[model samples]
Target: MKFYKKITEKSKSNSLVVLVSEDTDSINFSNDSVNLLFSESLSNEDLSSLGKITVLHTPDSLYKNFNFLRIICIGVGSLEEIDSNKIRRAAGSFGRYFLDSKLSNLSFFVDSIKSKDTDLITESFFEGFFLGNYIFDKYKSKKSEKKDVFFEVVSSEISNIQDIVNKSYEKSEAEKFARDLVNEPANVLTPTELSNIANNKTDKSISCKILSKEECAKLGMNAFLGVSQGSIEEPKLIHLSYKPLKNENSYWYIGKAITFDSGGLSLKPSGSMFSMKGDMGGSAAVIAAINAIANLKLKVNIDVLCLATENMPSGSAQRPSDVVRAMNGTYIEVENTDAEGRLTLADAITYAKGFDPKFIIDIATLTGAASIGLGKGNISAFSNNKDFMDKVKLAGDITGDFVWQLPLDSTSKKQNNSTVADIKNTGGRLAGTITAAHFINHFVEEVPWVHLDIAANSMTSSNDGWHNRGATGIPTRLLIELAYIFEK
Candidate 1:
């Protein structure tokens, strides 16, 4: 899509989108041609619903005068209640309308919105519109044809709109890249393939390294290796580092890169295993965030670690009673092979501590209980440091990738107690998310850390505002925003 910042009178597109406040009872349009069509529709339709889209087809004679085939008016709630996130959702609905109608050229008029900062409003709108246009049809034998959309943002005040547009475009593109990775089938996007993709990133400031199984074994990462033994494909431990010219305190982001999880020897039902391809959603988010951070030239030292492996069931798979030692010299007893995400993360977080990071954050599609607790919209977060976790929550609020904090008290810690080993992989059925985070906390030790259980937010069955039906790329933007905050 080609995005432009220009006056509404100068738009030469076939469609024009105007933002209307839900509190406003009457319709207002700057374009005479649009006013004539919209006024007619206003008399016949009720647009009191927020984010509701109403389309008005222009008369044959007026099309040439207005240079538009139709006018779409989207409601933006009360002006007092309007925020960047609301604007994003409204714009997303507008974008979806355009896609459904197969409209190629469109212009957005935000001149009606005068209460908010023009730059912020325009950027939010563009972010939502661009994200809403995302579609994953790679495997479709008969793909639907989509035209190159010509998008224009019309505003009287144009300062910083272009810069905002550029930045939002870059960030959203990075998010789309992550979504693509998550949407790929397990057959295509194996652990080795994921590592190769990370290695192929040609950013000069970013360096990529892939550790083979032999290297992992040499480093004593048996816990991570244990999860990989079942799969025929070799596991890859991916490390991507970004060093800025002026470095400050460094941080580590670890992602559980289970490319395809079949629950190992424990095994999952066929129904539950359908979307196991997205087991690496956390890894996708980290990789995408690193790509965006490098592209944006954020002057912060950061390291991304992905424990890439597939948890499959086979003759050589780790048994239920197996005990594996982690890189940090902690023994973990495997009570359930299905709780494999934490096993990989335990060793990865242990390795992350070697960097002596100021803070460590690990994201994983770790538990179904997390989804059961918080539903699919919010990420379940547990952090050892309150201040750092608050910063992360703030970042989530800013990015509209919400995170709800779950307790990690001493009571939850008792759930992981193991008689034979230091801790058990699974902490039974109760407080699954909390116990999982508690298990990882053992590896983090003194270094402040946050664990995000993204199982619910990774993929969605329904469209939610900026997110489409498939891979939502939940916390990629949150991580990028947090990186900027930490850098400051």
Candidate 2:
């Protein structure tokens, strides 16, 4: 989807998208027809919700002077409280509402939009609109008839237009890439298949290296390998790097790639295991974000590591109370085979520490306690440094990927104490999310770090324009913005 820019107060359009608020008395437009259309829309539309839209067919007799098939007025609630998020949400509504029709293009009226930063607001609008318009019908026999919709945005306030253009394209395409990967079934995207996909991403702009199971074992990645021993699929330790001409900073990203988690010997109930194919949501997030970062050509050095494997129960699967030593020489007592993602992530983080990055950020769908604690549409954040976490929170706020920090005090660390090994994998039921973070923190060493537990927000129940029924591909935008913040 491309957004062609036209800086004008008025234009002849077939289908137009306009912003509306409850207190919308008038918009100071150079064209009187726009003002009249706004007034007409306010009279008929209800401003009850942020993403609500009122589609009105203007009478041709009264509006023969201007060319328009219909006017779409999306609710933004109040102008005083308007922000980028509201704009994105309202834009999402616009994107999702046009599913039945087929069209080449639409126009958005951003000339009169009230915003603190025109670039930020315009970028947010693009993000919301494109994301909301997304649908995962790859497996459907009959796909959607709607062609890829392009937009012509009219805005006098949009300066530095090329930056918005680049970011908008990169961000949306990156998200779509991640969503498509997550939507792929486990049978199709096994560990080797995922490694091939990662390998294919390499070019002059980026570099990718895949380590075989033998290579991993040579480095004493026993805990990481233990989780995949039951499955016949060969585990892949993928390392992707993006190095610019001048690197201002360096960071590492880790993702858990359990393509199909059957919970091993600790089997999940059939009902709970239905969507286990999305267990690699973290891998998608990390991989997608790095892809965007590299494509945008930001002046930063970054490394992305994904430990790809499957956790299937078999006669050779790791059993209860089994002890496995991590690459960091820390022994882990596998109390429950279901807690397998953290096992893979632990060695990945330890391995990442070898490169001596200035900071490390890992994202994963690592815990159900995250969803139970914060519900859906929110990310659970944990970090050892407040400043780093604050920057991540700012990125989340900028991107509408809401991140809520959880407690990781010393008390949470005590839950993982083990009688036989250095620590146990499962830390009981209480504070499960925090304990999981604490367990991963054990391998992060002294680096300034933040862990994003995206279990709650990675999958959605409804197929809104912004989210599909499965694999929401969250924190991709958030992580991209985090790299941008680091650049500044």
Candidate 3:
């Protein structure tokens, strides 16, 4: 997909057309382009009723006289409702249309919206369209191939906004990289393969370091390595850093990268294990968000940490009574090997503490309790610091990530009382998510920290507004926004 600021009328002869209902400063539809109307033919009342889109397609044989065959009218729900997200949805709707119709090329005209500043909206649509086309196709023979996509901005003066347009595309590219990594089968994307992806992609702006099993043992990451011992694939503790030349305050983000969660000795049924490939989604989100910040050259210092491993059952797997030392030197009694995300997060959080960052935010598909609590609607946030959590909430609000802060210092903390070791892995059935967070909280100690239990929101079993099924990539934009907040 390529995005250009201004496409001349000559460019329209060979392409399918997309037109906006109205004309604006930065986008102007050529006469040859399809006219996207708000209503049946683009009336004021029709625009109000058309909440999302109105599309048309012609027979393949009549491709001449302008292949203006396919016309998609996107509804802004009146001029007042037009925003970046709506524009993004407009893009997604376009992608879905192309997939359904098997169309090859699309030329979009950005002149419809009333906003004079069409630059950001145009760019955002392209980004959203490209991202919405994402599918985990590694195992499928009927994989969808990339089609030629063109976004043509109709204004001559807004060409300088190409930077934002290009940045959005770059962000999408990094997101796709993370998506691909998350979608790969567990056999192919072992801890070793994860480290290789980091090594191959790092540059001066982003520096990556990988610690193998032996190195992890040397660093006292026993709790993390204990879970990895059951698998043939070794565990990797990954640290990826991005620093700007003028950064003032640095922040670190930790991702729990459980490549595959098999419930260890307490094995999961075939249904649960099938989608376990996405267990690494938290790791993917952090890396993808950091990759976006680096690509945009945001003036901030950010470190991304991923504890990559697979949780399986074997003779070598840790038992329920086993106690292992963490990187922070805390002893953890393994009550259930299936409760492994917090163990890996403990090591990653301990490692991140080395940098003495201003703040730490850790993301993970930590527990099913989160789903039980939120019901796949919103993310649960637990924070030790109120001000920092407020800042994070503001960021989420701005980016539309939508997080709800749940109490961490609830009765769940008392429920984690372990008589044998420092702390127990699982705390009964009630408030399981909060108790798991308390378990990880032991490692975060004095730092201003926020933990996002995204188990419910990170991936969906069915299609729901704005987000379809599979990895939601829930909080990437929120993380990016948080980085910006800390930079200031």
Candidate 4:
């Protein structure tokens, strides 16, 4: 998709999109031809319902009078409820309309909207349009060919529209990159491949380092290594750093990079293993967020850690009741091999503490209990610090990736107690998400930490809101927005 700014009345396109509010009783267009077309359509049909789409097909004789082939009007609720999200959804609707109609070019007129911040409205539109157009058909033999879309956002009074467009473009592309990584099959995206992807990011401010299995063993990261013992592919501990020329404080973001999880010795049923390729969704988000932050040139320093590995079942796999030592010298008793994400995160968070960051935030598809608790919409967040969690909640709100904070109290911490090791990996069935957070908290020590169990929000079954059908890239924008907020 290509984006353009300041589309004029003389602009020629295959299709034109206009947003109509629910409160708008009549249709208005600056172009005389468009006004006449809409006026005729309004007399015939009502086009004021929210999210209602009305298409005006040009008559054969009037093709030359009107520059476009079709005119699409999207109902955008009332003026009072107009916000960036609504504009984003409207843009997404336009993207779908373009695909369904096989139209290559579209002129999106935004000058008619009444909003306090036109820049945000424009940015949200581009972001949603690009994201909604995303499709993962790499393996399809006869894939549907889509023409390159020419997207024009027409706004008269918005200042620096080009800058807003560029920013939104970069951010949406970053998210698409993350989605692509998650959509890849496990046969293609291994631990080493994931590490290579991080290393290939050629940003001047960002530096990446991948620690081999030998190096992790020497550093006493047995917990992370234990999860990789079953897989034939070698595990990699990927560390990426982004340092600004001038920085005040640094933060750490760790992601559980399980490329494919077969549940190790404690295998998952066949029904539950289909979407295991997306276990690395958190890692994808972290890598993509850092890339966007570097591209945006945010002045805050960041350390990104990804524990990349595959949990498979084999002769060498870690068995139930196995005790593994983490980098911080804490022994974790593994009661269920399926609870492997927290095991890798235990060591990753331990390593993150070495940086002495202001706050450490770790993301993972850690528990199904989180899915049961929040469904597929909200992220279940567990944090050791209230102020830090509040900051994260605010960022989530701003980015439209909503988060709900769950308790991480001592009652949940005691559930991970074991007779032999310091703590057990699985803390029974009750409060599983909180117990998993507690298990990671033992390794974080005094560093303020936030854990996001995104098992439900990582992927979806259908296209809704601003997300596509699969690999929602949940919280990628939230992480970037949080970094900017923390920099302030």
Candidate 5:
């Protein structure tokens, strides 16, 4: 989709558009652009009413009646209430409607945002709109129609912010790549295949390297390799590094790349294994963010590390009462193989520690407790650094990729105490997410680090935001946006 800025004026071509909160009865447009409004009369008298538009409100399906090529609308609400998130959702609604109706080309009126600056609403909307067009249908036989969209803003101020928007879109594309990898069936995206994808799709400007199981074993990545021993596919320690033009600062990103987690010999019930394809979401996200940053040529040094493996039930699979050593020379007791994400991540984080980065952020679908704690729309974060976590919170506020901080204090750490190894892989049954963070903290080596447990937000069970059906690509924008602040 192409995005542009055009002076607010009447159009000469036919288009279909949605007027979010316009009063259609009082529309006074002098141009050919048909405005469909979701009036106070049409909207529900509640909070949920914000993004709701009904067929009865517009009288005509704007797509059906508008011979003109685009439909435009203004989202009417108080500035305090009409936030960036609302703008993003409105954009998603616009894009989904356009694609469902099979409208080939359309543009929106960003000037119509009543309270916020046109640039903010316009950028937020496009981010959501473009994301809505995202799909992971690589293996599907039937596919949805593609959409080409353009956002026309009325101010030159937009040009200054256009780079940010483009970067956001680029980040989303990288995230989509990750989402596709996560959504792919386990049959195709094994540990070895995932390493190949990472090697091939890596930015040319960056350096890529992979450590095979033999190499990892030599370096004592037994914790990560133990989980992979069950699979016929080879396990890989995936590493990619991006060195900017000027070496000013460096951050390490670590991800858990479990290809197909069947809980190893401990085993998950049949129903619980349904979405295990998304087990590698964290690794995908880390690589995606790195790719975007490198592509945008951000002048910040970075390391992308992934511990890729599969946890399956087989003769050789690691089992309960097993002890394995990590790359950092720490031993782990495999109390429950179901808690395998952290094991892979431990080795990756331990490996990244050798680079002596200023900070490290490790992401993974590490715990179901994360979903239970933060739900499906929010990320569960645990960090020892307050300043870094504050930046993340602010970034989430701006990008609408919400993340809530969880505790990782002594109480949380105590839950992970192990009699046999340095720490237990599973943190007792309660506050599971926080304990998981505590477990990862054991390997971060006191660097200004944060753990993002993306079990809930990485992919959605339904369509919301700009995501269509499968992967939400949550926080990809937030991570990239936060990097800009750190780099500055």
Candidate 6:
């Protein structure tokens, strides 16, 4: 999707989108018949009911006078309730409209809405439209033969919307990149393949290094390696660094990139194992967020790291009751082989802490309890530092990626205590999300850290809001917004 915010007279898209609020009365057009239709339509029915869309097709005779072939009016609630998210979801439906209607392009025009916050409305429109125009038909024999889509936010009310559109495009495209990676089949997106993708995408501002199994073993990443021991495919510890010319602060982002989670010896049922390909959603988000940060040229230093592996059931696989040593010298007793993401994260976080980052934030699809607790669209966050978490929460809210903070009580930590090792992988059925977080926290040492349990929101089953079904690309925009917080 090409987002050209300002459309010139010579470059007019065939389809036009008009936003309707309670305050909207008449939709003005140079054509008298077009104005007449809208005026009569408004008198007969209210077009401002939130989420109500009224589409009108041009007749054959009016084709000469009709500047646009089709006009779609999207009602965006009352002016008081108007926000970015509503605009985002509504604008996002354009993708479906484009595919179904076979429309080449769309020009967005909002009425008196310009008197309010035009810039934010502009940003939300582009972000939503950009993000929503996604389709994962990689495996389909007959893929969508979609040409370049032209999206122009034709706002006479604002002059600076073009830059916002460009920025939102880059951000949304980064998320789309991650979504494409997460949606890939496990056979195609192995640990080695994911590492190569990371290495190939590194720009001049960023440097990427892939650590092999032998190197990881030398670094004492046995806990991470132990998870991949079941599979013939090799594991990788990918470290990507983005340092500004004038570095201000240091930050670390670690992700659990389980290319496929077969539950090791404690295998998952067939029904539950199908979507396990998305186990690497966290790592995809990390890579995507860092790419956006670099593309935006954010002046901050960040370490984007991933522990990529696959947890399969085999004779050599790490069995239940297996004790693995972390890079930080912490011992973990794996009572359930299904709880493998934290083992990789345990070793990865331990390795990241050695860099003495200002704060470490690790994201993973660590537990099913997260889905049970938060349902499908919210991210369950646990953090040791309140102030950093507060900033993270604000970022999530700003980007329309909802975040809820869960308590990190010392009481929950007790559930992870083990008889043989320092801690156990699973903390029983109760407080399962918190226990998984607590297990990852055990490796954080004294460094301030936040753990984002993205299990629930990682891969959405449907195309809702700005995301289209698989791989909601959780926290990609949130991470980009986080860089803004520090930039300020």
Tens-place lDDT per residue, model 1, 41-113, is 6666765356798877875575555556776778788888888888888777766766677687877766666
Candidate 3's C-alpha runs over 4 A off are: 1-9, 12-40, 43-52, 55-71, 115-124, 156-160, 246-249
Q: How many residue pairs clash in each candidate?
A: 0, 2, 3, 0, 12, 0
1 or 4, greater by TM-score? 4
* Residue lDDT tens for model 4, 237-265: 99999988454457898888999999999
Lowest summed lDDT across 10 adjacent residues in model 1 is found at 1-10
Checking candidate 6 for backbone clashes, the offending pairs are: none
Tell me each candidate's TM-score: 0.93, 0.93, 0.87, 0.94, 0.87, 0.94
What is each predicted model's overall lDDT from 0 to 1? 0.84, 0.82, 0.74, 0.83, 0.73, 0.84
Top lDDT model: 1
Residue-level lDDT of model 2, residues 219-324, one tens digit each, is 9999989999999999999999888845444688888899999999999999988788888888888888888998888887888999999999999999989999
On TM-score, who's better, 2 or 3? 2
Candidate 2: pairs in clash: 132-465, 132-466
lDDT of 3 by residue, 243-288 (tens): 8855455688888899999989978888888888888888888888
What is the lDDT ranking, best to worst? 1, 6, 4, 2, 3, 5
The pairs that clash in candidate 3 are 38-42, 52-75, 54-73
- lDDT of residue 286 for candidate 3: 88
